[model samples]
Target: MTETLAETTPHSDEPIPAYPMPRASGCPFDPPPAAQALHDELPVAKVRMWDGSTPWLVTRYGDGRALLADPRVSSQSTLPGFPHPNAGFRENAERRRSFIAMDDPEHARIRRMVTAPFAIKRVEALRPSIQKITDELIDGMLAGPNSADLVSALALPLPSLVICTLLGVPYEDHEFFQEKSSLMINRYSSAEDMIGASDALTDYLDELIGVKLAEPADDMLSELATRVGSGELTRREAASMGVLLLIAGHETTANMIALGTVALLENPDQLAVLRETDDPKVVAKAVEELLRYLTIVHNGRGRVALEDIEVGDATIRAGDGIIIYTGTGNRDPELFPEPDRLDIGRDARRHMAFGFGVHQCLGQPLARVELQVVYGTLYRRIPTLRLATGAGQLPYKHDGLVYGVYELPVTWDA
Candidate 1:
């Protein structure tokens, strides 16, 4: 590893750019210009984190994929130098420890218990149910008014409904969980707020599992309750898993749907590809392209090094923290030509929108299917859906751990 001592280098005494440098004025759909600059200029160098720690920021596409899969790198949040997603998560790392924060063996053990529900085949089987849910939501939207906020009408509720049915959680309680989930997902949320939300959801899930224990249902939560009964999992553990699934199951995909819709509306040339097509293959291609173009998980994936590893021109040492900017990596020109352009016709299955290792999104299959349904049906069904407000006026979730729009005001001709 040839170490360089540039002004932005992590090891140098010179000034270093902050981990989440601000996004440029006009490019809301892209990563922060400063961070994306590192993708090409200093792909494997350190950057100052919020806590004043310097963690290696892996920005290049190849480097990010290599490090994420590297055995010497670990995802355990309990580790001292681990780069947590936010201050709240950092403060409560120990208490919030779930399989996602653990490395291999243990991670594999706990993750497998819930894998059956998200398996590709099982997820595919739910297409009809998902399609039905999507159609019903669109029906409600079309019948109600000429204009509606797409986030509340379609994006947020669709996944919430689907996940609720799968997890045996009542859709009537979505507001409670949605409010709690929002607090937890906001990157700048106070430690107390995040902790409070986590505790509330955990308690709620615990009680729900108790019901499943007594009156078993044919849902994922019932399976978890059975595990608790068999002494395979603790009641608390089951509840924690429930919290993760419920939050992750909706939040991430919801953003993609709303954000993707906004991006498509802004790019009429791209929107035409979807509105004019009934082919599932065409819709699936569009989903991948949108996933890559938007790349909603823009904060970057964090990990800690377990041992010394040489990357590009830098040697990440043991105990050092790492943050892989996968969202920017998806825009790597080397991997995808004209990467910045959203080309639905291009084969984009190789994009790292979901990520590239063991911790890649577990609900990716379900998310893809949902997006495919929405992209295939929504525009074609209405054939006139358009943004009611200017894109610049919409509030984007730049402060949250996820990247999305708060409200997507859209209308269609009746």
Candidate 2:
């Protein structure tokens, strides 16, 4: 039912718009207007990337979902024509092959080892501990300065503490790992810088895995170490898994906590809905709505075509690069009514914020519980919580893999 490029653009002479288009300053939460415009006219259009490769930029919700779930589309970055986010990602794509970048069977094998700890039931069981951490952080915030940077005070450290405890990694060494993670995900980092960061984290994890092997504990790392000892996984493989979980566990959730707080503060109507809601179901729905409104992973998920696949109005040829723009997809009008508006009551469970198919986030349950507890607890405890600065004045993480506020300055009544 889709049209090929030959049919749609035989006489086209206009240059394709570049990818990673800037969001309109007036509407920082929305996806780039230029990209959204593409969804209106041509849901699947070609865009040149940083590396000068023209990949199909899928903007339609249905098309993005189809491509993401299709086996013909691959997530493997090592493929010759894979669409790497930047020079830095391209340089280290093959070197750091976490389960995220691998195909089925191989990806499934390693993902299984860590899946049990993150299952919905398991993650739900940690809610009490997570709630305790959130309260403690908020208490510290209240006891200290009237005005504080939420990123350092509550947003960043809460997740850092949780992930560190879960992985059995020392929280005292957060600075080292956090710096390496920042370098690894920064858009402007050089190839060498990315490789160096990867190596440093890998080396650190390798040593930690050694420690866990000798002195086993009741933690995710200890489980991985047991696998290594039993010859089910190599030491290097175990270490790589540790690095992936450590970085991913904290970074996404931390950003969500900070950015979600800002978004709620900016939209008072929506904020009221969350503040007044005591029902767990309502809080859970609000979390999904926030996830959809701010699809924080601004960078499109990249893939290479294993075989020719037709989607929407284009035939993706084998070796063609593809970038599924989930940010735009989440806002597609067809998927959600008034897609631009953040409606807490809407059923947004189908949103691609954590992606779709087998590659959907492994830690989503944990993230959901964390957000539910924080959003439910933070506003109730601090009813007057509001942003200290204008939303436009705040700096955003446009240059990083994940989209979020760098420092959310907030104030509430004492």
Candidate 3:
């Protein structure tokens, strides 16, 4: 085999401590006992990946955040000898149809197209619509007999509707997109299942782009299609951008809606404060804290070193893959005093959940707005909303990169 990166072959004195890595199985919401084992044993350790590759897993908050911001560690997966986890799958080619799979210049140019649309100003303009969606969902929830699966009644659909409307994707096909997106992240799905979902999502987006080209609408997708047709963006670039917006625009927010609702249900006192507090700033800060507490990306970030670099105590040389375990970092006791506790009041603005630097989530503002609207309105509307089932019985998606609940059954006195 061609030599791996120099970093992979460190000297004996520079020991690469062995740590337990998260497997594709196990509960996602509650931290895997294995991750805590690794965190306690070696804050920074060499983990043997499922794919039989060795990569440094950074566990400390400071180390993970610093590495995320470091330009030397490239997020691009197309590098030489770079082992993409999905490489052998027939569907990997189609799955790479998003901007997340590209490097700079290409990533930068494409990301810029939707930046303005997702900007705080643009997102703020959608508040009225978001509020309507939230209220409508809540209204429907109220009309239900007594109990409701918040995930289905409100959390899931709110963001899906908002994202679909924003992207000009047909709302009728929302379930189709959701299923494909779920399969893309689902842990239990086979390799063929994953590849198929990836391909299907790409083809669906391609068709959407084609429709957007012939008849533009007052939506982000239409705007992007105009740019692409005008020659500002290549067809491939346009497809990637659309896929990013469509998938991310809903999936992350959908989880936040479900997970955030669970957080409020579990902590009624905090939920009370959020309901009564009129301060958007405070609500925004609380959202950040909740994100940190629920480090959805339990598997850590997937990246490869572009050049020789030093992260924390160790030196990482070119080509060595790195997975910065955000879940571990977010809970590092050093960064977060009493890190495991859910303190919405805690100042967690520095958390790397949305990641750091260039590749930071582009839809953060829209997400924030969607979250604020959902949480701010839901509790106040049903001050007594409580989980209908025992917390243990709640369905959680364990296999995917994002560890989130499936259905959050909640009820309020009618």
Candidate 4:
């Protein structure tokens, strides 16, 4: 069952195939025969990258998990002397230190501070507010004319509101800060634009942090500030986490809400099943399936070989960089049977969509709750939800690392 890259094929002079076009590029979600071919014949092969350099893409489920859990591998984007895709985007790599980009003792200490607050129990306590927010968004969707952009009307706003509530951000100022955050995440934007947005977001967070220090509320930001004041966390650490919560809380979920609706609309039978069920457990299962089906964050986790290590017959020498393609690993046939299908109860709990090991997504609990509320409410509230564009004409992200639709148009009877 377990196979290594050397067992299949070794490095070759023949040119590696161009990166496979994502299903988000208007094809079906099934992994192309070409991709699966690579998975089988060369579980780990160097592929031509967008930047004209080659990066090893790990496709087999076991190899991906092994690499993800390996201590020699790191999440740091700025590992000195290693080839990185982000080399152009970052200047003085030491300047940026995202928690996701940190390793070991530092990552452990900072993560411990926020773990309890993001735990399922703490997130469940916000159910009433989340439900109320969902209802309000549904009301707005109904109030609009029959045809509306579901993304702008609901998907985008719902996550923003929920994150604001969690962080105690004033709802009134969300629009301004959310725009700044969006600009930072949209990779298509120029390097200058990204840097500007990052500065603007940091400035905005500093302002909010100042306010929280003065009038501490029962919010995460307030709690972070309290920790900082008590010398538990540095001001820089507190600021970084605040920005991370805001960005991660919204960007990924916004895509899920937008793209998941597209998937359900494509399969009306599944939509019917979900619409008829009001049970939280059922909705939760459906959310997992949708996450698997959408596979929005196509980009993989980045790692480097600190020393020579043998992986599946291939010895990656010290300083070689690798990327564990999580999206590919989640859909490996050996892991999920009929990997392309969207079966809500397919028992896909093993999926790495939220990733695995110590670096698993910290905000996963909140994301799950948001999806359940949004999807459960959408179908029940709008029994006639359908795509406004023709099936073949729906717009989707073609080349982004995180694949999602540019717009999700939908119509429903009021």
Residue-wise lDDT of candidate 2 within 221-319, one digit each (tens)? 899999999999989888989999998988999899999998889889988988888999999999999999999989889999999999866788999
What is the alpha-carbon lDDT of model 3 when measured against the actual structure? 0.76
For each candidate, the alpha-carbon lDDT, in order, equals 0.89, 0.89, 0.76, 0.76
Over 98-148, each residue of candidate 1 has an lDDT whose tens digit, in order, gives 788989988999999988888899999999999998999999998988999
lDDT score, candidate 1 = 0.89
Candidate 3, residues 280-322, lDDT tens digits: the string is 8878888888888887766577778888777655777788878
**Runs of candidate 4 exceeding 4 Å displacement:** 1-11, 17-25, 28-35, 81-89
Lowest lDDT 10-residue stretch of candidate 1: 1-10
The residue pairs that clash in candidate 4, if any, are none
lDDT string, candidate 4, 1-414, tens digits: 336544655457468765533453346455445566667788787766555656667777788888788888777767753334443345424655667777887788888887887889889987778889989888877887898898888888888888888888877887777777766655455667767777677667767887899999988889888988899877776877788888888878988998888888888888998999989889999999888766776656667778777778677767776767666677777768888778887777788888776798898999999999988889988999999987567666544456677688899876
Q: Deviation in angstroms for 202 in model 2? A: 0.9
- Clashes in model 3: which pairs? none
Residue 160 local lDDT, model 2: 86
Candidate 4: worst 10 consecutive residues by lDDT?
A: 83-92
State the TM-score for model 2.
0.96
Order the candidates by lDDT, highest first: 1, 2, 4, 3
